[model samples]
Target: MNERMTKQPKAIQAIIFDLDGVLTDTAWYHYRAWKALADELAVPFTEQDNEQLKGVDRLNSLRWIAQKGGLALSTAEEARLMAQKNAHYLELIQHMSPADLYPGVQPLFAAIKAKGWKIGLASASKNAAFVLDRLGIAGDFNYVADANQVQNSKPDPEVFLLAASGLGVAPAHCIGVEDAVAGIEAICAAGMRPVGIGEPARLVQASLVVPQIAALSIAQLQALA
Candidate 1:
């Protein structure tokens, strides 16, 4: 946990979640789609290249791939390519079900709801609702702020802030759960406590770092506030 010099909020009234790695393991589908597109374009995209796409929006990720491939395109070409990639991604994730949810996610949702803390989803994916609906967890959240609602991506705080606002909670009164470094930064920037669900070394700045969502508890989360 990161030491804080400032006084922290007293109670956690809401919990904001990132929908990708934090809720489900859809990153593999994202990578596969991007990789397929890259192959078609003859770009040397590796899993390592896909790491940079975490928390990035679709068009921007395509732009990064284009930059790496040394390919330039007009505005119209960019839009078409982005649409193609999204189609591929959608096809790959079409069969997702509740079973596709990450371990401990369902139990965690039950626990959070039992505690009466409002739940909000903040994701850079424009397809957040589609994925959530497929996973059968769309009704679990009290509010959702997807890529369509925000102009800026993670590390900019816009998405998380919007989620907090949607929940009718102050940013300081919420806990943001994430599985990406950019997400942690965004939560902190939004003045919310960050609970990182990944490697501690990479999430040292988070208020709490857990190996997985299953390891999280309402007691552990309340301690942070």
Candidate 2:
């Protein structure tokens, strides 16, 4: 189905968002936590390696780090490592406030809700609910489909599909905004319009690539959808 370049739908009834890099800047905390673990293990994890973790699950990211360190782990060991990383990340984000929301995020959310568009959050993080609550914006979304609710992560299309279903909107009638390659692919594969929120080159597959969500408008989004 050449999902990489699908046609936009005539209307966008729902806007599904990825939590970390999109609505908040928790990606930095994820990277810092991973980096701390890698350092403790004497692994050569760099910022570039962290980039590869975007839209990927916590355990998978740990696995990738282990692969870089040339280590194989038992299931229990992997679970321990995953828990360690998550604990570090959770600690880092415990101090987050609504001030952590990206510029224009609240206004954009308000504008979208004002237009009666359903908002859904589709994030790989199990802490998505906590983050939203801490930001005091938990009520902003119509529904949330996080890692706990999905068996698969981004690039599998499961999360986005679930978000669309939760929003009671057809996939074709939803627009997904993401900042990672896997997320954009998931949106496309889910048969929804993909709106990239980062580098244009990295998200050339999206229906519309913008520098940030603040740069997008309801009219622009509708037209793209």
Candidate 3:
């Protein structure tokens, strides 16, 4: 989606969120699935190793896992492994409830709404809709940019730009909350301010970096403007 704003930008009129790491800890579920595949392939996998997969697409994630084992995969093999990993991930996330949503998600949404700011989700997961449904906050988002709708993933800005379009706001009038470097880069590339939801060291490029969602206050968000 195009991100060039025709009109002059305004204050933060929208807040866009990344799914797995920002809204929920489904990154753990993803790690578990990839770890299972890694174990099967005798690849030495650790939480640190899984960090590289954050904000990455399913196919690239598979490549990261396979590369760990120094394994080369054919097209068919790659598809099969990705499907298997996704199946495992689906099973792992089946038990998710609103309780699984990260701390402050609800309150954050309410706060944003109070500010007259729209909220949208720019998740790389094709299951963004399902996960939002599982969390019982599907209606909270003014728009949810489907990963399937974007031509490129995070670090490319297409998805974030799409979220801006869906929100009927300029990219410059948005704050994109993310927990990965790639996501932050995407937000920046889309011309939106980035609220990094992780360690400051890991997300130094963000306009504002908070330890987690709850630590991200309205005061901090307002300052981004």
Each candidate structure's TM-score, on Cα atoms with residue i matched to residue i, is 0.94, 0.94, 0.93
Q: Name the better of 1 and 2 by lDDT.
A: 1
Candidate 1 vs. true structure, TM-score: 0.94
lDDT per residue, candidate 1, 96-136, as tens digits?
Answer: 99999888988989999998999999999999999999999
Candidate 2: residue pairs that collide: none
**Which residue pairs clash in candidate 1?**
none
lDDT of 2 by residue, 89-196 (tens): 999999999999888888888889988899999999999999999988999889999999988888999999999999999998899999999999999999999999
Give lDDT per model, in order.
0.91, 0.90, 0.90
Candidate 2 regions with alpha-carbon error over 4 angstroms: 1-9
Give per-residue lDDT, candidate 1, residue 161: 94
Give the range where candidate 3 is weakest over 10 consecutive residues by summed lDDT. Answer: 1-10
Q: In candidate 3, what are the lDDT values of residues 1-225, reduced to their tens digit?
A: 355665434688999999988888887888899999989889999999889988999988888888878999999999899899989989998999999988898998999899999999999998889889999999999999967898798899999999999999999889999999999999999999988988989898897998889888888988777
Comparing 1 with 3 on TM-score, the higher-scoring candidate is: 1
How much is the lDDT of residue 48 in candidate 1? 81
Considering lDDT, where higher is better, how would the candidates rank from best to worst?
Answer: 1, 2, 3
